[model samples]
Target: MCSFGLKAALLGGVFGLAALPAAAQQTKVTSQGITPTEIVLGTHQDLSGPIKSWGVPVTNGMKLAVEEINAAGGINGRKLKLIVEDVGYDPKRAVLASQKLVEKDKIFAMVGPLGSPTVLAAQDILLEAGVPQLFPVTSAEFTYKMDPKNPQERLKFNNVPPYTDSVRAGARHLIQEKGLKKPCVLYQDDEFGKNVLDGFTQALADTKLTAAATTSYKRGASDFSSQVAKLKSDGCDFVVLGTVVRETVGVMAEGKKLGFSPVYFGSTATNVVEVPALGKELTEGFYAVGGMEIPYRDTAKGKAKEWAETYFKTYNMEPNTQSALGYNDIMTFAHYAKLAGKDLTGQKFLAAMESGDVFQDMFGSPPVKFSPTQHLSATVFLLQQIKDGRWVVLKRDLTN
Candidate 1:
């Protein structure tokens, strides 16, 4: 009987030993880019390219957020570190930069990567590695859409209103409120342009109206003579621009040269301080649909005034809408990261984000929220016009 009892005890001990690894596996944290004292994040931007004007301020804004957060003790005691790469606004270069960030740097996530084409080129690589692409600067709808068959596509989340929705809001305002008919479109032949065109077309369809003329241009083309001529010839009284800052200015200037003075509408891409600064007199009376509140320094009050003041003191430059966006993106990420707790993981952060909790930004615009199905944070936008050399808020919370 003693011998039998000894054998049974030995068998029980062996079973317990076998279960140890399974228990450890169940509790082991599966997060990357996290150290006991630091969490590493990275992004690629157009630091030396055509859009550097937009990229520089955005990078600065993100850095400012990192500084403020780290100074305030960071998220759950882990300091945040941001690594930025210059991609020159090129897709191939963006892909290469993303590979380095993922493979060499081993970043936890990507925040505020600029341009739709660049993001599209690098998205698959990051998604395949299960890294969260958080709050990319582009508002392309694909940034937030999830594919049920491919769960990896769910890794991307966007804080800005999609380009489609922004265009739709602008179109609705122009057609219904402003009494503008004879609409025309000048769009780039790319995903960004296509999304804007789609929204404009959908909005017109909803109103049973048709665009008078539509023209496309190659991306990064400087001269807008032909496209502007086509719209002018079509007698387009209201033109929707699917162009970025430079293109927006170029097209409007070309129109001005030809003495065509139709009302111009642009997506959030054109709603930057550079538009007025670079375009000068030509940008006057231009209207745009923006996902966030216009960061007008002179008219700012309350939280926005304080934010602008702090931003100016920190960066030695006035803040624009892009700056506001960058600051909001990092703050939003940190908020969710904090909610994920001290034992943070990418999956936990994602779950916290998908919990549909509303986040208040520094500018006191509308609260942002996300969910499993709805990954885009802001669906509504405000319409603003460049009046007297500054962006003036014309309408708030315009939606289609």
Candidate 2:
């Protein structure tokens, strides 16, 4: 195993990238994590922090997938090993976790690392080491945007619907149908929140309107009174939320207490089951953007329904959107890895992922189409609303 710090210092580079050697950089994607009978993979998620609502269940789903695959003889007859590190949604810790995974664990690929800032901070290390960053939980634009001049970027692929596109589609639809003008935005002060802000701004631009007000809160904050009060005071008839499950519930519940009734919208991250489950009456009629259907066991059908029930039986907990997505992410990885054939390498996996294949999940998500030049899985978005504690699709095939 190569030391991550030593690799950076060897070339006096920053983030192990600034001064990479030409020959080594050209052949970075080798079969590092492959063994005669096993293939090791890695991921980082916020298991103990604010976003654990997402991390815990997502990891549960991944574990379930690994079990399923291993029992079926694994991918190409080699069992899969997933090493998870809890980053607590902290970027610095994310980097250190990435170092440990890449250098010490010698993971072949980094799959489903959580958070926008954390993935951003740690991705260069994975890329520098020639390990592919696949299906990261974040939908930040940089995750899928390949730099034409950098071949290393070709290893990056994202399966999640982007925040910018999802919010833009939902916001635009609401503005057109409801004729809402006094738009306000309450966002977390971070990379994820900024994308939401940008999307809402673009939507307003399309409808020839401007924001009535915008406020931000720090990540992991439990109090949203001030931000809610600010938007309420601005007379916002519609508000865009840049929040995850907890913050989403917190802001909306706070708004209800303050009698701030308006159309509330959120990006894909808020489209999970927790939003409706936690907020209940407070979040009724809340709108959100996403590409995957929230897998409610009672309402899910076909393979999706079966999977949800099996998940509950195995884990003794109800399955959510993140759970379905995490399971799907691993299955998708296996599909491509299998296509990479028995001789698996980072280069082969990259080619397999970019082989113009369309992957569909059991949970009725938008079809994931990956091509040689296109890394983003889905571009179209869906608008859904929480009605009677369940998400109902309001519109489909929405675009920016």
Candidate 3:
């Protein structure tokens, strides 16, 4: 469902047990990952690769959740066992890693696997084996947008705000609020980039505006002089980006070098703390839309402050946006797993997820809800900007 090169980055309640098929139940009832002592879940991350920036912190977050869950006497007496593999953000490695997880580790579910290409490459293995894929890191469309004809699609669920939805909200808000006349997009020529491009196009169409120009760069290219120059020459008043951490900073830096600054905007992925830290002054005023609020210790209050303190004390490093997500992903999974109770099977777990229960995180993200038909979570996104080398919220609850 996604076109990719290198990337970074539930059932239930309403339908009840009757909605689950006998074949699926038969395949999962044995629950390979569930033992008398523990429940095994697997994840693949880019520990030794490019996006390890995301993978390492996320893994740390998952560990925190598992530690907390297990400390509470584990989930219904079954301690959580998370076996993580280093996929290096490579699709081939991801497939191999997944095979090991399924065949050897015997993971009942795949949680927070990183990278779009990697997840896509490895997903079929898990699905065919009847292992549930929960909350893989990439926010690409296919992670949750399933074909109704395919029953196995329900086995895949996503929590991160999709790239398309966040971009749409950000683009529309910029055009109207900033009075942008000529909008354009400089996207990465890959799955993640294409999703941003689609969102940009859709946003322009919604505003009854047309794109001034659109250009793309290769997946890992650093020099965006040509793309930036093209957008500048086209007189684009605003430019939507389909870029992650490094590329986001690269594009803006190039624009600064050329003295051609427009209203720069990107998806939730660009709303990361890394951009500001890396880009320094070049990234100031850069805007992006995000679902999760960045929780800084000084600014955070109550549970958020408490969580940050706990995270730092545990990891001996400060938490960033990715850390929060990683922690939330496993916590969210654990929440449903707990609801699944002692006789946790694939169907019961799926049911618990779709039971329309509201999940709220300490980071002040939108409450997540899943249903039999709706798997994608988080409709609201916050529009943020970089000011003085830190991300500041500009607007909240941006929705189409």
TM-score of each: 0.91, 0.92, 0.93
Instruction: Report the C-alpha lDDT of model 3 over 129-148, residue by residue, as the tens digit.
Output: 88888988888898998665
In TM-score terms, candidate 3 sits at 0.93
Q: What ranges in model 1 sit over 4 Å off?
A: 1-30
lDDT of 3: 0.84
Clashes of 3: 1
What is candidate 2's local distance difference test score? 0.85
lDDT of each: 0.84, 0.85, 0.84
State in Å the error of residue 212, model 2.
Answer: 0.6
